[model samples]
Target: MDAPTVSRDFDVVVIGGGHAGAEAALAAARVGARTACVVIDPAAIGRMSCNPAIGGIAKGQLVREVDALGGAMGQVTDVAGIQFRMLNTRKGPAVRSPRAQCDRVVYNREMARRVVEAPGVEVVAGEAIELLVEPGASGGSRVRGVRLGDGSEVLAPAVVLTTGTFLGGRLFAGEWEEAGGRMGEAGAARLSRSLLALGLELGRHKTGTPPRLCRHSIDFDRLEVQLGDDPPQPFSFRTGRLDIEQLPCWITRTNAETHRIIARHADRSPMYRGRITGVGPRYCPSVEDKVMRFADRDAHLIFLEPEGRDLDDIYPNGISTSLPPEVQEEFVRTVPGLEGARILRHGYAVEYDFLKTHQIRADLQVAGVDGLYAAGQINGTSGYEEAAAQGLMAGANAARAAQGHGPFVLDRASSYIGVMIDDLCRVNPDEPYRMFTSRAEFRLLLRSDNADRRLTPIAEELGLVSAEDGERTGRKERRIRAAVERLRSVRQGERTLEELLRRPEVEIDDPAIAAALEELGLAADEASEVEAEVKYAGYVARQAAQVDRMRRLEARSIPAGFDAASIRGLSNEARDRIARRKPLTVGEASRLPGVTPADVQVLLAALSGGR
Candidate 1:
């Protein structure tokens, strides 16, 4: 005697409503797909489980690209942000990025509202216990939908898994362990087995957060106050102004004593105790890792960030740990301003299952499984921005696949999203993958200020952007072109205005350049973009030529199921690697590990019927 299974239908079914799932569902619905987002709790959609902030370093460029593609992250960040600052202001335009401190609760609520109000999207409360699969036309497995914990099914042609850290998640602090993604939320215990049953390879990754401090307990007088910019820049291109009241974040440092205490009790940490086998993010290491790796440094800077305008908890940006509660308290008290701080919640590490990147195609579709996609932490990425970008692409591609359309793929030259996906597909990261400006070879063309210029037209053609937004982008482009043309035409005593801009001393706001730009009625952002283009025109052209050369290789398609064993002169290592990766293009095959330049030349010769 079992309960009857209640079956429902949707064009696309998205599992987990975190940052990735929310974007997936929204993007699917935006493309006119009947989408359903299944989550353990509907209220947790877009929850900032790690930090109460969005966009930092290379991450800000990602948010702008997501916005240009009509994704909700940048707009939602603009609405929920409490403080905004443009990082790397003194550096060149290529590395300058926007960061925003947000109200965590408000961000979650606003993102959930967007998902709920989105047409053709239904938010369903349930844990996905199993993936419903059927025999594919090619005698392989294909995902048909998902089976919820209640023995009900949401049937769809496509399924997207943006499970974050919830799939077989285990939280650890000292000797205590629990089956949960976050502190209070339960993990999807059964989902990992379902993926394993499909013959998908899974790897483990660990990430930790710092303890939240009771704001009233901290001594504000001892801290060095860091204020937001006077005219804070917005993350979203559509956001006209930031009218919210900005708050100040404070900084303190961990002294030698703090490091000593952590070193003394390091064995109590789950990671140190040999209880956690997963590899964590190397860029954002835990406190114990930091101390052990950089023992030469006696102090590490910590920023005390506000969680929200109405909340009393402060998030310490640095010193994330999984030490025992008492040790956490003891080490935290050694810091300058936190001498008497009360821990609202103790930090802990969570280890979860993620699919090996090589199993997914460029469009995020599972290589051997049809109608199945994965994004977010499930794909071994670390940040919310990376997750959202993948989710947008996955959801849009899923919808298109369901409508009998070809896959929509982005190249590394187009945007950061493209760069990230290219890296993920070409290389299997051993640790959690995080975005950085250095990761892109053509970073000069991938600046944060010009994401809209780089990607808006493609998004509009894909039906991800509104006609009005598309027209706005077109108008901005025209103005920039006209301004550049005018600069080239207007000559100074010895050089044109464009030539003056190329000089290191002359800025966009210089008297002569400012007057000329003002005549064209260009906004501050547009004028700045013009300046960057004029200044780096030569470098940009060189990179564009490199991109063109790469595109020629990418255009040479590698037929599916093509056997590398037939190609003579390939090294055994290259043959084995190519066979396992199954690269879809000659360009991808060239980028695979162990596949040398000689190997690429051999591959080209074999494909072209040459020696």
Candidate 2:
């Protein structure tokens, strides 16, 4: 055999090219790192591994935050999105979110194009089989590079693992099983072993996708049509306008017959048969699980969403399963408006390994290892938006670490991304972690419309924001400030426009407010944002005060490399957990599972020169 090929060095190396890896590579390169994205198939970058959509509820807020941070997900969706809707329009401003159904093929193409054309990024078609590390003087290992399948070794100071579900992946369809990350993709078995050897704890999680039906076979006349918003709202602050034609999705329901068919085949499911030992997500349960758990319910909604404009496949949402092919066919016929449904692909569940998030820092760096980071599904988060957010943070911080910069950490009071990172580091989620409005205590300050305000400045500080992006951000800020000042100066019925907006019955589009907005030349979306700020001013102030009080606890710092085992007045369990996690602050130690408020007080007193 010929000698193994050794590739040139890069500053940062990113493995796996899904949403997480794609964003990671892009962010690293944009931040001036010589980055390489190693993937099984270069063309599969940012492939929609599950549904053909992005953003929903709290997830939408994350996508906006990613865009604000000079990341590519938001801009890409603007180009590939086929349908857009603003969720929670009837709810409070803090809860409203924008979701988009994208054309899968176009999304992948655009994402790959970005990775390929990025200035300092190189896309390499190779599978990484091993992680190379060297022992540091401090008795810890630091990442040196990764070994690829083609007998080529790529060297880098920092390595980001956005491996997604490919790490020891196994797919199941009823009684049938195969080793695959996605439908036709191979699993990363060797890398999983390498990770185990490196001493990182791994746990298994299972996620499923619904079957794809032929669009031509479905009778859409009997289904309810769901149209896009009248004036579609783009996810990115930089997207000037969406000029493409919109598509409408259809809604159908599974009837009693559908339930009966699913129930009869429940025993054949890998999940129910005990063939799959991995824990599945509780929030997005499969059809069989839902049917058995909610036997009293008569029907469940099934959305018939088009996969792409050119593709004939339809994604049926809310019925993900891993049942036999025959059972899937029989159940499709039982659903309303799907009597003649043709299966383009069978729904299957994939079980894969994920590292426990407690081993990760708020900056996305893996604990006890220098120059190594983990993000995306490997961190146990369930949504594409969540993965991309983590990837952006991880990639940027990894590049910074390689350059000897301080670790970049977001505070919980600032953005939803901060809350997510804090949650991952503080608690080990029993189920797959998916973001929701209820999880964010400071939702009022983390509204979807203002992610740019909260994060772009930070991105600029980190050298991720470009000149063009900074200019756009500046323009938007000016308009918002101008509009708010105009509103504050004008009076409507004895109250200023800003004060009038605080009334529950008033809207930004009210005659007086609209005329003022027109004079100020503010866009409709911009006006809505100003309206939210004015209406929620008091609540925002109150939340900010609470944040100030909490920051005192955060300010009480613990010494570096502080040993929890050395502290007194702590429970055994609390000591064990704190020692393993190595929390940096007294506040972080206070949030450990078994740690009590009294324990926190004792730790604070001890750190402040008390016994």
The local distance difference test score of each candidate is: 0.91, 0.89
Report RMSD (Å) for each prediction in the order shown.
Answer: 1.7, 1.9
Task: Give me candidate 2's TM-score against the actual structure.
Answer: 0.96
Spell out the clash pairs found in candidate 2. none
Per-residue C-alpha lDDT of model 2 across residues 287-370, encoded as one tens digit per residue? 999999999999999998999988998999999999998899999889878998899999999999999988997678888777
- TM-scores, all candidates, are 0.97, 0.96
Supply candidate 1's per-residue lDDT for 565: 87
Worst 10-residue lDDT window, candidate 2: 1-10
Index of the highest-lDDT prediction: 1
